[model samples]
Target chain A: MLLRLSWLLALLLAALPARGAELRLLPPGLAYCDELAARFSRLPGARQDAARGLAAEGGRLCEAGHARAGVARLRRALRAAQGAPRLARSAHP
Target chain B: MPHTRRRQQHPGPLWRLLSSAGFRFALLFAVVFLAAGLAFAGVLWWGTAGTLERQTDSAIRADAMALAERGRDSGLAVLAEAVEERLALDAEGLSIYLLLDPSGRRLAGNLAALPPPRSGDSSWYRLNVEHEDTGPGEARLLVLDLPDGSKLAVGREVSEKGRLRALLTEGLAWAAGAALFFALLGAWLMRRALERRLTPAATTAALIAGGDLSQRVPLSLHDDEFDRLGASMNAMLDRIAHLMDGVRGVSDAIAHDLRTPIARARNGLEEALLSEADDPATLRGAIERGIADLDNVTRVFQAVLRIAEVEAGARRAAFAPLDLSLLLADAAELYGASAEARGQTLNTLWPESLPLVGDRDLLLQVVANLLDNAVKFTAPHGTIVLSAWREADWVVVRVADEGPGLSAQDRTRVGERFFRADSARTTPGSGLGLSLVRAVVQLHGGALWFEDAGGPPGQPGLAVLFRLPVAA
Candidate 1:
């Protein structure tokens, strides 16, 4: 009986907690992220700023993935300004 | 000693007696302990093997996981880097890691091509890694499912763990050595303990063998089983020694005492021969003197024959179911003549049908010997009887006499061979008659009694009683 208890303890010790990022799943095309972004904005003030940055950067990321250079450049400009505000807030906070 | 030609070592009864209990116990202890040690050794080996196997598996997996972290690309590039890095760490490392697409195509590492992922656990496998001689004989590889429609293959083959093998070999040696040491130790202790207990018995036996009748095994304060056995042996030896002493004295007395009459008769014959015996009348008297000497010698030989026959167990073979009443009648009829010849009265009383299982001839002889002694020793007009009855499971026979009885001291020593009352010593008979009677009664799983019959101041001549079992 004591041997069995030691066996369980050894196995439990060996199963360490996973330490790196895993795949943050996304749906096909652009539907699920937009829905998530909309729900994100409806939260409180700090959440609203973070949500606007995600929406702008999410669009630019799609453009990059699709390889539309003109669309990507235009969105990058928009996203850069939005991204700068969150960075400033985060740095101050 | 070997398992063949056992007939070549056939020892006599002396060897068999020496090697009985001592040898048997020693052999039993050895065989059982050896088997137990072997079984324990096997269990120890199995337990160590399992521990070593599990440790090897985890060590190789840790090595692969650390290598996998450094690869810069997914699938194919990661596998190549993991394999290359592991080889650089240990030149002969037989570790193989493969990542494959769903279509069974090689995606990474040193694997030139991918084989299908196993359906279940497998035996030794071929991975696309290549190495020169002194390579692993066979590799242990497992296909593990990864989350992205790909799989991770991980394993390594080490010839053996050198340290574990060394420890196992050393452990087995120690275990065997301990078994041998303890077995010898235990056997020595057992032999010593056995010898200690047997010492008293051995000394007593040796004393008896050397014709010393006074030796006895002493008991100790512990009152243990060995003490009991020693005490019992002492009691038995006492009995046997007493019997042997009585036999020796009786024979010695018979030679010394009985020879007087023979010498007297022989001297009478010489005197007659030297005298002027010219007539046939004188010659006839000399012949009578020689006949008496011959009669005494014949009586001595007859007595020896009767006692020897009783002890020979010959009568025991003639045992059968018979009526005790019939035996009593025969004893009365057979001895009735002698009683009448001496002008004595003889009577018989018995149950109608007293059934008993015994040697009928011996039982009859026992009764006859008692009646004969009664009639011979009784005075004229004395009463004698042959009686039998059944009490419980035994048939009891009694021969009572109304003659001058044996004194208490004489009655006790009456059955010793050649023992005779001073008055009855003048009678013409061998003294072994009653001894033979007692032996026959004893051999039939029965009892005998020598009790006093009625007399004036002291008990009269003895009443000899005997009993035989009805059903054996």
Candidate 2:
């Protein structure tokens, strides 16, 4: 009976993540947490704190089915994490 | 001769260089090159400075637009704080800024003073701007009035652009100077080379002009244009020398040949006068003999003059197309009686019409002289043949006689004035007959030559052949 109950718990764990709303936010076959973590890993050490905080908030929004706002926030996090250069070298004046 | 030679001086190197055609060409090229270079440099300067000025104006307008929008969104104080923040950046003095109140006093920013405002989308004005590390610097400025009665100024320092322009101007000046120097040097070198090529011809000309007829322009094996000209001039000089030799020969021959006849006539008269008896018949006979000798001498002079006139090409104006066959027939007829009296048969072989362009009277004389020579030389019962026919582009007339032909040595000298073959010295005629024939032949653009008519060795008959160009 204990083994059966353990198998049932395992099944439930796999089924729960697959059924979550954040699954749609990931690219096909990718896990939500993994995509967020990949972005998190590319952040420079000096900028990791801000990027991590933003990515965490974006991941939570994806889980709540706010995919549009989540994708926008994720892009901002990706930009900060990647340390992209400015679009233009604007004059200082 | 030595004194005369020493009088001519060598031309100086400077004079030769200056006089060379190549030097003139090079100088002209240099002037044109420099003028074009100056124009090109001016265009480059104008284009580069104009581009920089446009870029600065564009940047100022964009910055002002952005700042004006920010000022509209927030208050004057916030815009002032933004301007201060921009000036505070660690960017090295490439930037300028000025914020002024309605009273026109600087409230915030880096610029120390602004010029009067001008109207345009973006107008450039000169400004002095203060920097933390570099004290005050000159800048290009653009000013805009805000809705709150404040003025915002944006500018860029001109020192870097000015430094680049100064360097470019200096480079252009040096390039122009170097171009001129090389042009002059090239011109000088080219002139020297041209002078070297032409010097020999000039020297030869000077020598010839100084009365040395034997001097000729030297030639090399290169066969270039100058060499060809030298060769042609040498040929002309050779022809002139030959003519001079011929003139000298004629003069010497006249001095000796005329002296004999005059001396004979004088001696005859002296004998007639010295005879002791009063004899009118002897005196008359002597006078007649003297007159004959004088006539012979006069005939020689007349023949010489006629030959000279024919060779001068003056009779070419009287040339007309005539039938050579008819002329041949006329000559055979004219000399037939003389040939018959000598017991020689005169035969003529001519085409029905043998046309040629020549002076008719001269050509008739030519035929007459040839026939006469044949009639005079041939032995009794010998054959004299006169023939006329077209040979290729020429009208050929041949007079052959069964007489002693000229020896090879005699043939070479036969057509010269006063020259007679050893065999023909006993004949009663001046030696100028063949010479006159040759001159007439040459005047008609024809050739005259002799050949041996078939016979035994040392007894071949003389065949005189002459050819004239057929009339077109």
Candidate 3:
């Protein structure tokens, strides 16, 4: 009985590693999603409308338990909200 | 050895140049030029770089006002949108903009973050910014608080203006260097010209100091100031040389003329002393002859002293106004008896009044000397004419006789001290009479001349004429 108990403990340890690996593959947490939403809301100009639509879709996905997909959409929304004119653009032609 | 020592004592050319007036003037010129150039640079800086900076600040202020007005009339969101649009339109990326919410989070425009806030409602800030396109640079911004609790910042990068100012400063420095070089060159040239112009006079002075009295300063055809100075120096040197020659001539004449009378007087006395018989009559005669010879020598000395005194202007202080005609008449009357003794007719003619300023005794002596010469040289039964008159601004006196006139060469030399004419050599008088006459006339500012008396061909007599300036 003691031997069986040792085997069960090793199996449980293996299962915990698998779960941690799976969590690593998923998107970031709810805090990151909230930050991206704030950034998107602050964006200026007409290009922000498309980013607003993408953020709404990401919020719905997160509510439906597709956290990885929702996080991906939120990231795409933030990039779009940055708009056509960016700080990284060169001053000279 | 002295010449070598003098050469060694002279300074080098560089030292001379530094001490020269021309170099000093050049240094003054360079200093003035540098000051003027710096002043001009200051003005240019104000006109170009300073003006550009002011213009940039004005534009930034204008943009900030516009953004604030938009936020006031419409909303903070519209103001943010306007900032983004302006950043998109700026092709050179020189424009800078930042819109911040009340929480200090950047919402739009190119800037990543808002600058430090100040207490004022609106403020200007000069900040070092890391531009996304142009890297690090300076920016001038005007920050304004919007009505909706948002902030708008408008600015322009000023690195290009700084670069232009630096270029202008470098160019002005080069120009100043070139001007200094030219000023030094001009100073050296001016010193060379000054030394060249003065060399001739310096050399002549050196030669003269070494006992070469004939050396003179050379003149240039330019007839400039230096040439005029050289000419004046030459004239003074000539006058000095002439006076030296006159002194030598006077020495020779005194020795030659005085020796004869002294020797004769000595010989007569010696003969009397060496005689065989001790005779009183012979001794008295010899002694009397010796006295006469010594008296003649004394007379010559007295005449020389009188001439020297007159020439020295000693008699000028005793001058007073007197009628020259009256003086002449008195002299003629005194010498008339002498002319009568010689069987010569003495005739006098003069105006009633001939006023002039002179020494009366000296003028009388002048008339007496001419009349005596006339009486001595005139033939017996000849007419001796004495006349005086006023001619223009002068009192003229004339004495004419049927005597042998002087030759042309003797006329030029007549007034020289102890000079006697060949024709008058046998006469029993000193040759200082004409010289004394000349000295007295010159002292009184008068003129004297000898001319032909306009007599018969073989008897062209001498006429002594003189004129004194009329008294004012």
Best model per lDDT: 3
Q: Write the per-residue lDDT of candidate 1 for residues B335-360, one digit (tens) a residue.
A: 89889998999988887999878887
lDDT of 1: 0.63
Candidate 3 per-residue lDDT, tens place, B204-291, comes to 9999999999999999999999999999999999999998887788788888888999999999999999997688999999999999
Best model per DockQ: 1
- How would you encode candidate 2's per-residue C-alpha lDDT over A55-85 as one tens digit per residue? 7776677777664445445545655665652
Model 3 clashing residue pairs (backbone) = none
Q: TM-scores of the first chain across all predictions? A: 0.31, 0.47, 0.54
Candidate 2, DockQ to 2 decimals?
A: 0.01
Q: What is the alpha-carbon lDDT for the whole of candidate 2?
A: 0.74
Tens digits of lDDT, candidate 2, B143-232: 788887888887777657666766886887798788778867776676666677678888988998899999999987789988988888
DockQ of 1: 0.02
TM-score of chain B of each: 0.69, 0.75, 0.72
Kindly report which residue stretches of model 1 are placed more than 4 angstroms away from their true locations once superposed: A1-93, B1-38, B48-95, B98-122, B125-153, B156-181, B195-240, B337-343, B355-361, B426-428, B459-461
Error of 2 at B427 (Å): 2.9
lDDT of 2 at B266: 95
For model 1, name the residue pairs that clash: B76-B107, B76-B108, B79-B109, B80-B109, B404-B461, B405-B460, B405-B461
Instruction: Tell me the whole-model lDDT of each prediction, alpha carbons only.
Output: 0.63, 0.74, 0.76
Q: Docking quality tier of candidate 2?
A: incorrect
